[model samples]
Target chain A: MKNLVLASTSTLHGQEYLEYLLPLIKSHFRDCSKILFIPYARPGGISHEDYTATAGKAFEKAGLQVHGIHEFDSPHEAVKQADGFFTGGGNTFLLVQQLYRNDLLPALKEAINKGVAYLGTSAGTNIAGLSMKTTNDMPIVYPPSFNTLGIVPFNINPHYLDPDPASTHKGETRETRIREFHSHNPQPVVGLREGSWLEVKGKNIKLKGDLTARIFEAGKEAFEVEPETLLNDLN
Target chain B: MKNLVLASTSTLHGQEYLEYLLPLIKSHFRDCSKILFIPYARPGGISHEDYTATAGKAFEKAGLQVHGIHEFDSPHEAVKQADGFFTGGGNTFLLVQQLYRNDLLPALKEAINKGVAYLGTSAGTNIAGLSMKTTNDMPIVYPPSFNTLGIVPFNINPHYLDPDPASTHKGETRETRIREFHSHNPQPVVGLREGSWLEVKGKNIKLKGDLTARIFEAGKEAFEVEPETLLNDLN
Candidate 1:
């Protein structure tokens, strides 16, 4: 069984880090007091220790203590013993690279499968999908593979933005990029907008937020899945 | 000596393929009658043969003949004997992947060094830089390396977009992505907006177009370079 909060972003516009997610975090980790923070994403090229400190301040509001995975003797052991897990957002490539480098993917997946409370924002949420193929993050570093935890049946594109109708920029839109991904891959994808998240408990996954999430399946017209919709195996 | 026209895009908004660049193309390859087209980028998942034919029609308007590298018995020899070269835009990952798989990087570099007139747009322009690290394209596929021609002293973010002040999207802006790249890399980057290009002749490279190009340097404030600015060894 899985218990996860995969959010589109860590911070929303005009909000502090994880501020909007505090109440949800409190309920998610109500039975636990400590969280193992994986700060490898390093948003803005921040250091792991620095990123962890930032996450710690946010976790404190939820009445929890945070420990960075970097402080442990082994990342695998850190996952094994964590009361809960939280991976913050940053460069997806660097995050995936570090996960492979530390051999933490399998361990983290196993832990989450056993119902360890988990929270993933942005790049963190991306890795919970079938692959990191749909991430909008720049490839600052090349990971050995695009494969991820597959906690969910499909891929996720976080912070998904609608195309600007008035803009003249000719670069492919987010929808175009995801369509291109579909051209080369068979996996379905969910475009998760900011302030939106998917709550997973065992085999049930529900869209939880004020906004509707766009769902993209191969050879099908892309459509929106409304808030609170049960979406597991919908593909 | 090198002769190149690295464009921000193959076709500007509301224009036919290579229409705006035809006059420039005519002048760049004034002495050549035939060109070898490397249609490896495969924009929008287009096929090599189909993309090559499209380039052929565009080159015909400039009074030049187009031959795809795939048509030649030896792509290496085709590069050595090509009167001119044109690499179109598509997925950067696939383009670079094919380039290495076909062993065309060195040959193309050698040809460009020997003063072959060359044209690149979008992903094509990205590879003309020190690396493809600054590309705005998604990672649909993984190439053997991020290394590129390094024909220019810096990296290039083609179809460079400025942050929209009116929007509320939380995804990292293009500027932020480049800044993050600078954190892990020492390479300078040029944000070449649509309708902009770099005109490279031997040791001199000039920014051309009506808009100012944004320049990003490591460990320093990013600035803008005016059109026609001489950029060789500017660092």
Candidate 2:
């Protein structure tokens, strides 16, 4: 069965990287001895090797060995052979650009569909949905397309935040941005807040974590979904 | 001479639409009686007519007539005939998409280069730079390209925000986002804080308003420039 853990962020406030998701990671990839890391996202513009090592240290705590896809002679071959995968978050534009340049998206999608364990955080989580249009990241680079894995029927707005009642910043709020997305896209969107994640087992998709997620469907008012709510057929 | 006012935002905190810029607007377009408005950004998904009306109401206070480009039978013709222009803030992706869809970019650039007075706020201001790569707006839609007018030598980060010392949000800060853009793009970026603007006269560009603007040059530490500082040769 297909299995995945798509999280809003790799770290919560005042927490170590992937610290909150370690327990879930250990259980999700229990069957796999090795996990391949896609470090194209490169948070803070860190080197691919450095990003991979960060992921490796975290996965090691769960008794799993991790290798970066960049280390392989062929990224496509790396995706095909890996039993588990993790894509760290950074600039979605850069991540998408690198993935397209390497022609690794197809193999990665196929591997996930074939039941290889997968974990995505932030930009990584944003790509698991219908499109990357709902992402909050800046357009640091131009990708060939906005299409992604579409492992889920809907899109994801990771690092989703509620509007501050006191502040007066003029930038579009997260909710406004998602509604703007609906102006051009028909896909539904899930606003996943920090410390929350989606757990997918086969065709079943459930909200995992204690917080409630905001849901945006075209032509309908945005509403909240409680934890453990099934979201596989959100559309 | 070429004249333009590119502001970080049209509205300031607790201020009416364009309230903070009325005097500047009056002096900037003193030579023209009518202004052609580009309402493609459509803040909050407002209709072009309504957004144009909003601009009209604001510009009327300065004794200037305003009409939306959408109201014209040919947006291209509208750009060519208008002596002054204003592109309101909205989603940059949507604005760029509509401009490209109507094949209006070249004409618009030509008109501006010919010294037609122009005003841009937020997303509109972002397009006056080398590219739309530094905008903070969500990618609600995919544009054909990230390229913009190149009326200026650098990119503008409109409504530029400082990182909140108290907030725990994990989303990339404005500075981090711009640095990431530098990773792929070579253009310098100006972080125009709220209420600050750039005044372009012929070949000269100067920072205006009470606040200092942050300047980011690739491979160098970001620094702040005082108000009224010359910005035309930032690179």
Candidate 3:
């Protein structure tokens, strides 16, 4: 059985870091006494130690002891030993690069597949997908590869925003960028807006939260799926 | 005598494609009679031929003959013989991938350095910079390298937008992403607004158009440079 909570964002507008997801996280990691935190995706260029402390502070409310992988002698060993894991949000390119550099992606993937409880937000959630191609993050660093954990059958576009009909910005919209991805890649993409997430248990994946997510299948029109919709068939 | 007009966008909102930059482009390519168009960065999943025709239509008004690199028997030969070049906007990853795949990057760079008239918009303009690290496009495809032409010393964030203070969106703003880039990369980044561009003549580079471009230097605060300001010293 696989247990995972992949969210679009760690913090919502006007909310504290991971505050809105605390209730769900408490129940999700209920069985684990310690949670290993992967702080490679340093949001706002935060240091690993500082980022880990932030996560530790948030998880304290759930009575979960948190340790950052960076603090360990071996990140690969840390992944194998942890009962639960949490990866925070930042630049997806940097996160992916660091994961490859430390050579912990395989161990992390295997741990998640072995049913270790896992939590991912934004850049973290983007890596849970088949590839990081649909990530909205800038390519600040060149990663060795775009391939990810493949825990999810499809790719995820985190912090997805709908095009503002009244706006005049000429940059490619979230919708347009995903469409471009489908042009060269065959994977379906889920546009997970802020405050929404995918809850995966075993082989069952359900869309969680109140808002509907935008679904994009290659060569097909983008459609919306409501919360609680099973997304296992997307692969 | 490098003649180049690297624009932020090919089209402005409510304007025809490449409409806003026509006057500048015409003067930029005035000495050339033929223009070779590279349409590998196909916007909206448009076919290569269709994208080429679109460029042809726009350049026809300037009384210059237009032909896509794809139409030539040998793209390398076409580049060597062309007096002017136009690389239109689309996906930066795809454009770079194709440039490497066709082994045309070296040839294109050589031609540009030899004083061939060159015009780039969006993804095209992105490649004119040192690297595509600051590009806002999705990673639709994996390119051989993030390295680019480096015709200009700094990286470019085309269609650069300012943070909307009133918006509640949780997505990382353009400024945050660039700041993140600085943490990993040392290159300075120019945030070129839609109507702004960098006009490079020989070793002299100047910000053009009506808007003041945002400049981000590594380990320093981002600042603004007015139009006609020389940017040659940024490197």
Candidate 4:
């Protein structure tokens, strides 16, 4: 059975890293002693060692050892053999680019599909989708393709923020950007609010967290799905 | 000599479309009776005809005729023969992709470098840079390439926003995002605020408008440049 946790953001406002999701993460990786962390996204351009250490500290609280995947000679082999996969949040373009560069997409996909527990936060959650077209990150780097691991059927819009009606900025709102994504791609997109996560246990993908998720599909008005709703049936 | 107006946005808060910059736009295109409008950016998903009509109305205020580039059989030929070019703002990726598809990048670049009056707002302004990698727009569409006009030596981050000091959003700030961009790309980037525009008169590109512009270099600290400052000297 496929086992995965895709979270919108790693930290909520005023919360520590992985603080809110720690309990769920501890339970999700209960059986594993170690989790491989992919730090290629490099949030704020942090080093892989530093980013991995950050993950290491959080996972230590959960009593699990964390290792940076970049330390291994063969990232592909590491994914194939690891007991778990933990891709942190940062730039999705850079993450996808490295995954392709190291030829780790297929191996990671196969590993997760074959039951290796997977945890993705922010950029990590984005790669679990069919494509990274709905990401809110800047195009700081150009990836080889917008495609990602289709571990889940639909796409994800992570760190999903609703339009600030009070905002006077002329930049397109998050809703407008997602709407434009539908203009080019018909795939369903889930705007997972901060603190939201999708718990994929085999075919049952339930929306976790206290807040509701906004779902948008081509040709249909966007609607909100409740916290406990299952998202497996979404097209 | 390059004669181009690269604006941060088409409209400012509480103002009509191109209202604040209409005077400069009219005078820039003083020798032209008609301007070819590029609407592939499609702000808010407006159609080419509709977006062009919006531009037509604004230009009509300046006693000039307007034509949508899509109306012409050969968009390339249209750019080559046009007295002026106007690329509206929307999605930078979509604009770059359409330019490549219609093979209009070269023509537009050549015409602008040849001293034809050019006006670009938002996405249009983004394409005036060395590459689209610094764009603040969402990656709603994957363009064939991130390369752009390079009419100006540096990249442009249009609609440059200062982080809200009072907000609690944990997502990376605009400054943080641009720093990450420098981590990957060493090119210089200019942050064009909402009310700012870059006036490219021959070899000198000066920052225009009432607001100051932010200048970001690959390794140096980001600093502010006052209005009327010549940007050609920036690295």
> Scored by Cα lDDT, where does model 4 land?
0.91
Candidate 3 has which clashing residue pairs, if any? none
Model 1: docking quality category = medium
lDDT of 2 at A75: 89
- Please tell me which predicted candidate would have the highest lDDT against the true structure: 3
Winner by DockQ = 3
- TM-score of chain B as predicted in candidate 3: 0.98
| lDDT string, candidate 4, B11-106, tens digits | 988999999988997788899966899999988678899999999999999888889999999888889889988999999989999999998888
What is the total number of backbone clashes in candidate 2?
0
The stretch of ten residues in a row with the least summed lDDT in candidate 3 chain B is B57-66
Worst 10 residues of 2 chain B by lDDT: B26-35
Q: Per-residue CA lDDT of candidate 1, range B1-235, in tens?
A: 8999999998888899999999999989889866889998787677789999999999899898889999999998898899899999978877898899988999899989999999999999999998888888778777889899999999999999988897677888899999889878888899999999999999999999888999999888889999999889755
lDDT by residue (tens digit), candidate 2, A65-113: 8999899998888889999999999999899989999998898889899
User: What TM-score would chain A of each candidate receive against the reference chain A?
Assistant: 0.98, 0.98, 0.98, 0.99
Question: What is the C-alpha local distance difference test score of candidate 2?
Answer: 0.92
Per residue, candidate 2 scores C-alpha lDDT tens digits across B53-118 of: 999999999999998999889888989999899999989999999999999899999999999999
